[model samples]
Target: MGVGEFSYRISISTLIVVFPLLFVFRLAQGQLHVVGSLQPVVAGPGDDVILPCQVEPAFNVAGLTVEWSKPDLRPDPNDRLSRVDYVHLYRDAHEVPDMKLPSYIGRTALFTDSLREGNISLRITNVTQEDEGRYRCFIPKLKSQTRFSIVRLIVDPSLTETVTTKAQLDPENFHVPDLNEEIDNKGGSSERCRLIPVVVLCVFILLCFAVGGCLITESQKAELKKRPI
Candidate 1:
C-alpha cells in the first residue's frame, strides 16, 4: 500500500474508534443524573416515611454519596425556603462532623450511604405536620464525582402529624350530622357553663339574706325584752 493510503486508513480507523468512545461517555454521563422514587407518598402519623431514590447510571456508582433535604417554609426565596432549598445535608461522605443536628432536624432520620444498591432512601421517623413538603435527594457517583439533582416530594400536609390524637381533628373539614344539632350542642355547653355559676350565686345570696333576717329578729326580741315591752 502507498504511504498516504496507509496513513489515511489508519486515521479513519482512529476516528471511528474515538467517536464511538466519546459518544458512549456522553451517553453514560447524560443518564448519570439523580432520580427519586414516587413521591406525594402517604403515611399515617408517627410512622416512618422512607424516601427512596437511585442514580440513573447505577452499577458504575462507586463510592457514592447522598444528601437528603426537606423543603422548609422560609422567608428567603431561591434560598430553599422561599423558592429554593430550605433544609439539606451533604450526608454520607461530607456529613458535617461538628454540627450533627440540623436546624430543621425534628423527628427525622436520614440515610445517605445507601446508593450502592441504588438505595438513596431516608427514613423519617415520627413524621409530623411540618414534614409535609418536597424532600430532595441528591446523589453522585463519588468515583466519577459527577453529581446531579433528584426529584421533588410533594406530600400532603397531614403527613406531618406525629402525636397520637383521640381522632384527627381537622376543623377545616368539620362535618355535622345536622346543622341544628351542632348548634344545640354548642348552645348547651355554653348555657351549662354560664347558668351553673349564676344559680350558685343566687343560692348563696338567698342563704345570706335568710341568716341576716334571723339575726335581725333575734336582736329585736332581745331589745324588746330589755325594754320590758
Candidate 2:
C-alpha cells in the first residue's frame, strides 16, 4: 500500500476507536444533572422546610460532596479563614460543620439516608423571615453539563400566624371532658345510689330474722323450765 494511503487508513481507524471510547468515558463520567423545584418553597416561621434538589436519572451520590449555599450571600469580611460560608455541606459521607455559616448551624441538614438516591434536598428547621431567599445546590465533583440547581425559599409570617391560631384553637390542646366519660360517670353515680337502697333492705331483712330467732329461743327456754324436767 502507498504510504499516504496507509497513513489515511490509520487516521480513520484511530478516530473510529477514539470516538466510541470518548463516548463511553463521557457516560462513565455521568451526565448527572442537578434539579430543583421551580416554584418557591413557602414556609412559616418556626416551621421546618425542605428545599427540594435531586440528580436526574438517579445517581448514587452517597460518597460525593454536596454544597448548599446562598448565591447572593457575600463572604464575611471579618472571617478570613473561609472564602465562602455554606448553608449546609456534606462530604466524605458526613456533614462538615466547620464549613457552615453560624446562622445555619444546627438548623440545616441534608437527607443523608436519601443520598444514595441522589436526593440532596436540604431541610431547614425553625425557619425565620431572614431565611427567605434563593438557595443554590451544587456538586463540584460532578462532571456534568449542569452541576448545580437553584431553589427559592419564602417565609410567610401571615401563614405562620394562621397556623399558630389553628393550633391554639385545636380541641386537643384544651382539657375538655370527653362526652362518653361524662356519661359513664353519671351512669356510675346513679347506679351506686340505686344499689344503696337494695343493700340497706337486705340488712334489714337479716336483722328481723335474727330478732325472731332470739325470741323463739327464749320461749323454748321458758317452756323447759315450766315442765320441771
Error of 2 at 32 (Å): 1.8
**Regions of candidate 1 where Cα sits further than 4 Å from its true position:** 1-26, 59-65, 71-106, 111-113, 140-229
TM-score of every prediction relative to native: 0.43, 0.57
Task: Give the per-residue lDDT digits (tens) of candidate 1, residues 1-229.
Answer: 4446545755665565556555645544453334454334566656656655555455433354455554243346445543333244454444443332344455444444454555555566665555666555544334322233223333345555543222122232221122222211211112233244345555555655665565556656666677853
Model 1, TM vs. native: 0.43
Each prediction's RMSD over C-alphas, in Å, is 39.3, 38.0
Residues 1-229 of candidate 2 have per-residue lDDT tens digits of 4446545755665565556555655564554566777666787788888787887668988998898888777757787874667899999889999978899999988879998888888888888999998777878877554567667788888774323211121222222122222211211112233244355555555655665565556656766777854
**81, model 2: CA deviation in Å?**
5.4
What TM-score does prediction 2 earn?
0.57
Lowest-scoring 10 consecutive residues by lDDT in candidate 2? 182-191
lDDT of 1 at 183: 19
The candidate scoring highest on lDDT is: 2
> Which portions of model 2 show Cα errors greater than 4 Å?
1-30, 76-82, 161-229
Backbone clashes, each candidate: 9, 0
